[model samples]
Target: MKTRLFRMGLAVLSLAAGFTLAGVVGPAMAQQNVTLALPAQSLLFAPAYIAAERGYFREAGIEPKIVYVAGPGVLTAVLGKSADFAMISGGIQIAAAVRNQKLVAIANTQDRFTTDIVVRKPVADKLGAVPPGDALARIRALKGLTIGIDAVNGLPHSFLRYLARKAGMNPETDFTITALQPQAMVAAMKSGTIEAMAFSPPFSLTAVNDGGALWITGPDVDLPEMKTFPYNVVLVRPDYCQAEAAACRGFTTAIGKAVALMRSDPAASLAALGKTFDRMEPEALRQSFAIFAKYTRTDLGLTEDMYRNAVAFDRAGGVIPETAAVPPASELYAPSLGR
Candidate 1:
């Protein structure tokens, strides 16, 4: 019995020594690589920019690569395995969910209604100036007014419809929504080509500062039903999550730390963001940060009310198939591995 016990102790010590030697000699063996795709126009993604710049991912044993794509294309890139994960709007996720897309929201990035409607100063003057509570009435009063929108069927458009309905006007009949890129919206607004637009900051900020006036801000027209209206969320494909569960969890932990850092010190976060978006002015960046700070929840948890509202919007609008089953929020959102 003594001889057998001695042999087992020797074997255990040898295995421990081997593991210690491997740890000392090959630290990189435990590290992971992850790629995240983000939309070009989101200030909400500032936390992600901070994570990449600040080496938080490195600290968490991950090497992260960030790719810029249009909001609509992010999910497809992840679904196709071209990217490991993506940051996308909750509305898009809900729409995709109705189609039975195999994507799960791992973090709740930004939830606030950040989109706004800006009208030319002259138009605002004609409509009786800035605090236009009856702005939809004024907007409806104008026949054939063109409003710029990023897409015909996305958040901007959906929210615009919601605002019009709140203001007691028909969006389809009252105004013409012109599809324009965010940058182009600024140029169009400046040139007086498009009288009004549904815009996201810094585009909205740019318009207001450059002489456009706010007709309506998104939150003012409350769509209480829309919960988990995620402006941007971190998503991983099911197959990728199943294959690399540990790596995905590590990435989430790193990202959660980044989000906390950003929320705690936005000025520092903007400095990090400056590395990627060089043209972003310090003031604009600060303003952008402030706007996003109000609505983004760094907790990485999706709200059920928000998800249901988004799902309803997509379903009612036929963005998602009528026959599709909307997954419960729990099934759609993964718990924050970071916490």
Candidate 2:
């Protein structure tokens, strides 16, 4: 018995040192099922889509099915168990908690705001915004002009509201706001009807290539409120996470690998993205990669500051009640089982 104990102890130590106490790669296990919802078809979820495209899901022994949901609906999908996981903004996660819905973010895909305010070239040139050289000045020039947004409660509109506040202008009082789809936004910009529009990738890229000026990029402009916000998160139910800890860990690990592939090999990453964004031109896809690469996260962790900001934004917008204003970020996260 003493010898058996000693051998067992040695085996554990060896296993910890990177030796799989192996039997061969045993017979394949049934593919674990996972359903993940994304907020949209944006390039922001590139890493995850890449994982699915590159067989990382297969390699991790998970069969992942991705669905596209818009806005807060992504969270609702996960909360109702219609999806096992979701990729959404941190704000929605915080807002749900205030309402007493128990969803948790297992991985954060971005720590900064990747969206920007893009203005039409003709509008910029007329306003002497030719390089949009000074953001504050150009912003001031937008007074009484028309601006477009994707939706009333979307990232574009939200950020635009924040920006107007910075210029000491009320979004409602200072200018006319119109909600238009990205395609329409582009058309409006070129047609000289809307002076500016704001949103995240794929669309942001389209805005620039179509003769709109990237007047201000969120983090790049050094906005303190925009930094460290965990704009994109990989979320799951706390109960679901606990029940399937191993699977959650494997899912995140596979995502980490996909993020790495995106950084280390642009060609391969672009190819992987092609499988999902097939409608985009090759140049357009490359343009999108250039715009969003900096925001992709290879490691996933939640942060308190991100939750604080998300909750504050939602509350200010009346999206969440004051009773749930302070959603605890720490309590809302259940890290994956140890690798």
Candidate 3:
């Protein structure tokens, strides 16, 4: 009887040891830390803000730290590996790709263009009635006005150039395109320095609220050949996606969930996003969020169509030189990265 008991005890101890080893060798289920870079606080990233606020990133085993790097430095942040991902305009993303930057878009937040052009009410009054929805007439009216943009060669500047060309004016000679910070643009417009400004919300909306008139709005007026484009997207290094596949996949998944929530439950999502955009007026924030959600891609997938339109847009804006070789869209996005 003692020998039998000893044998049984040995078997039980051996089984317990095997289980412990398995636990040690198994895959981890803990949260992964990631850094995301942003240009500034704008409604263009509403989905990302929603994802973070609703614990969607946490649900995907990610702890995201948002780093604000102004200007075009968000690209540098990702390139230097200080950030795991960056939210930026597709035009800049494509421009980076043209210069041989190894960045691939894993998720797109907004599929339509988001730039807005607002003229000081006084300037609009001078233009007289151009009839709403007549984008060409509106563009023609700005021929002699000085327009302020956040950055030269950015979406706003390029868009103005494209519009100027379409309106039968030389982008270089017909009007002036000036670069200024958003606040500075506001002050300049108030002081009659800049006659007009082009930007994304709520700067555009704020200008409109403060006695400016909307000449073009992203969600309202449809421009030629800009039906489906990538306005805002999440970019990652191709190698990072390969090595840390889970992190990239998780980030995309979080964005997907956020987009779905924004579409399915607008009131709740807006209520949550309002907290993130606490500085903006509640109604203005709601309007911006609604416009964003309306244009957000449903699957959060980055398609080749989006890329092609972006290239065309960039070319139209003169951001992409005619002589430069454009890389294939396949090289710019990871289709498998999204949920």
Candidate 4:
């Protein structure tokens, strides 16, 4: 009877050990696949690249795929179910929310102001040599002058409006805003088609290097409405977030890790970003990284004040209907995963 009892105990112990090993290895083998959509040319998308290249996503038990899309196609792609998530301008997200699209902002990538108003060198030089300190005055002087913007209702327009108001001018009455893509802004400026424009780097850097005058940078004006503004944000379709909460959490955690890495070692982050850019130039890459660092944050969380401000601006701009309820910051974000 004693021998039989010993053999039975050994069998039970062996079964328990087998189950423990399976439990340990199960999650590692069941990693989920996730896709992130990014714009083709913005430094704001660097963290995503960093996360993917440095294995942060993998470490978090996620298989992340990064996809590049055109400027206008990003929101549509997410809304149409072609992509899982995207990093886009805050204005776009606000606009979508106003339209009652089921999208949620998951992370704040570029959390500060970085756009600038640049003018043609000759035009600015002819206007009595624009001093860097006198940029607001220069912008105000160009009353009725045409200015180019990337979109009619996005960052460039919102920021320009804020700048105009701060400079004691109305965007509607003081200047004529023209819509132009980033790639074409320089050519338009060179040909004198547009006198000045609000742009983000490396486009801003490119324009300056090509002899465009920097008139007013976003931070210089100190616009009340734009203090500590949120720029690029990570967004996911509402359905995706609901259906794959665990996977989404893992993805956010991975991005947060990437942001931490970037903050700790920008040079290493830039090197990681270089892999994403085709024909990358080291100097340009470094400059681009510097510009991006000024705007992005590794916190990976949205603040209530920032969200409220963004919602108010959108509602006033008619991007979101006044009757539309502004969701709480908690509803619009999920940051616990990062912690």
Candidate topping TM-score: 3
Per-residue lDDT of model 1, residues 11-64, tens digit only: 999999999998887654456777787756567677777777987777677787
Off by over 4 Å in 1: 1-31, 129-143, 165-174, 226-228, 315-324, 336-339
Tens digits of lDDT, candidate 2, 1-339? 999999999988988665343434532445698998976678888878888999887777788999876666788898888999888777667766777876877887677777778888777777762334455555677888788876665666666666666667777778788877667887888788888887776777688888988887766755555667768788888777678876787688888888888778999989989978887777878977866777766666566676677766665545556565454657776554414
Question: What pairs collide in candidate 1?
Answer: 227-305, 227-306, 227-307, 228-306, 228-307
Off by over 4 Å in 3: 1-29
Compare the candidates by lDDT and give the number of the best one: 3
Sort every candidate by TM-score, greatest first. Answer: 3, 1, 2, 4
Alpha carbon lDDT of residue 314, candidate 4? 64
lDDT measured at residue 326 in model 4 versus the true structure, 0 to 100: 63
lDDT string, candidate 3, 157-257, tens digits? 77788777767878888888788877788778777899999888877887888888888876565665477787788898878888998898899888888
| Candidate 2: worst-modelled 10 consecutive residues by lDDT | 19-28
RMSD to truth, every model: 6.3, 8.1, 5.1, 5.7
Candidate 2 RMSD to the correct structure: 8.1
Model 4: residues with Cα > 4 Å off, grouped in runs: 1-31, 68-73, 129-136, 165-181, 191-193, 278-281, 315-325, 337-339
Using TM-score as the yardstick, the better of models 1 and 2 is 1
Model 2, which residues run further than 4 Å from truth? 1-27, 130-137, 173-175, 180-184, 187-194, 308-324, 337-339
Cα-lDDT of candidate 1: 0.74
